[model samples]
Target: MIDLHGFGNQLLQGAVITVELAFASLIVGLILGLLGASAKLSSIKALQWIANAYTTIIRGIPELLTVLIIYFGATSVLMSVASLFGYEEYIEIGPFVAGVTALGLTFGAYATEVFRGALQSIPKGQHEAAVALGMGNVRKFYRIILPQVWRMALPGLGNLFLVLLKDTALVSVVGLDDIMRKASIAVSSTKEPFLFYSAAACMYLILTIISMVAVHYMEKKASRGIKRT
Candidate 1:
């Protein structure tokens, strides 16, 4: 057993923070993905353009750069807006919030494409059938469309989440006490860079494995009605 040398508790705390950051970003990403997909599918050209621009721009940027921009740039923008309002106090975004926002935006851009593709995969004939049956829009979506969409989108979404989980390490750059940061701290204290970094890598791998198992279970549940041909 490679001794953690009293850094075990702090590393565990960092792991907890990592989990929180990942889940928070996941929630934000899911909401944005849904909205983006809806906008892309809308008849309005403006909405489609806006959604397209958002996904394109965010996806184009580097993830670490995105975190830095959201963290520092947001503070600048917030401070500027506050100055306009005569509230000249310094504005700040916490490390956790910054991490979640950056990771969420990146995750959302990809998830938007995932959801859009999934929605498109659902046949138009099904929608026509639902309409012919006199089903309301909401009823049709809930009863006929959403379940299939979820089944189709879940795998891609799961993969995105795995990426997002890893990206939480980027938050450490912004001073969030996540696993990577904790490992850095341990290294600084113990002068054992290899041990701490190796530990962090194992922790990340453990998280990935757990997420994969959960995704597999969910996939099974979502595929309940499909005949295995």
Candidate 2:
């Protein structure tokens, strides 16, 4: 049994924070993906242009850069906006908030393409059939189209979530006390870089394994009614 030098609890707490960060980012990304896919598929050229620009710019950059930019830039932006409302003082964005925003944006960019492809893969006949049944666009989408889209998008979204789970380490650079950051601290105190870092690696591996199982279950549930060829 390798000793953690009493830092095991700290690491566990950090792991909890990592899980929270990933889930928060996932929710944000899912919402953005839905909106982005809708915009891309909409008849409005302006919406298409905006969505295209968002995915293009976000996907082109590195995730670390996105985190750094949001972490530092958000504070400045908030300060400027606050000044307009007659508030004086530094409005600092927390590292967790910045982490979520950055990761969510990156995830959403990739998920936009996933969702777009899924939406396109859906047959047009369904839409026509819904129209024939006098279903409004909103009702038709919620009742008929969205379920199929969710089923189709689940695999891609699950993969993206696994990536996001690992990417939570990037938040450590912004001073978030995630697993990486906690391990760094432990290494510094115990001068056991190899041990602590190895422990951190195991933590991440455990997280990935758990996430994989969850994703597999979700995919299974989502595909329940569909017949596989």
Candidate 3:
């Protein structure tokens, strides 16, 4: 049906953009998530407070609002700072940057909690044993702690990634050429809302199915050596 209207090519391009947006946001979110989890689990009270505040503020806000605010707010701030340096040209963030930053912030907030829980789930004795082996802190983390963290965190992180992938559609509002934006254009041109929207939905469903399958495979691989309860 989509191919009949010559909409297939446009939709395919949009899907590529959607995947790029999702992946860029995922990288940013994972980095932030790791840092946030470390900060929250640290002994320093100030670090803990800062991490808690980040997650609390981000999770409390709506994702759409977060995108709008980050895009407009960051643009205004950047322009103001540039003006102070006597470079008053209208500097603006691209839709990609804004979308990735917004979505990544939201993803990181939730991922922080997941990582924190995973890190805590590892028993204290494991660390003790690593030290008993005279392993350095870095080696202990890499060899002993990190692998279990990965195994434990994979499922939750995978779920968050699916949410992040869907959330990439919200970037359409900011003028990204994602599936939703292209579909909207097609609808306007053809005056066929149902066809284009349904096409868009199907594209998203395909992405979700593929992602779920990949996650399941990774989970099975990660579960090796663990006894099934």
Better of 1 and 2 by lDDT: 1
Which one is best on lDDT?
A: 1
Question: What shift in Å separates residue 205 of candidate 2 from its native position after superposition?
Answer: 0.9
Q: Comparing candidate 2 with candidate 3, which one achieves the higher lDDT?
A: 2
Residue-wise C-alpha lDDT for candidate 3, range 121-204, written one tens digit per residue: 999999999999999999998999888988999999999999999999998998999999999999988999998899999999
Over 15-114, each residue of candidate 2 has an lDDT whose tens digit, in order, gives 9999999999999999999999999999999999999999999999999999999998988988899999999987768999999999999999999999
lDDT for predicted candidate 1 compared with the true structure: 0.94
What local lDDT does model 2 show for residue 115? 96
lDDT of each candidate versus the true structure: 0.94, 0.94, 0.93
User: Which of candidates 1 and 3 is the stronger one according to lDDT?
Assistant: 1
Which ten residues in a row are the worst by lDDT in model 2?
1-10
The reply for model 2, stretches above 4 Å from the true place, is: 1-3, 82-90
Model 3 residue 115 lDDT score = 90
Instruction: Give the range where candidate 3 is weakest over 10 consecutive residues by summed lDDT.
Output: 1-10
**lDDT value, residue 167 of candidate 3:** 95
Estimated TM-score for each candidate: 0.93, 0.94, 0.93
- The number of the candidate with the highest TM-score is 2
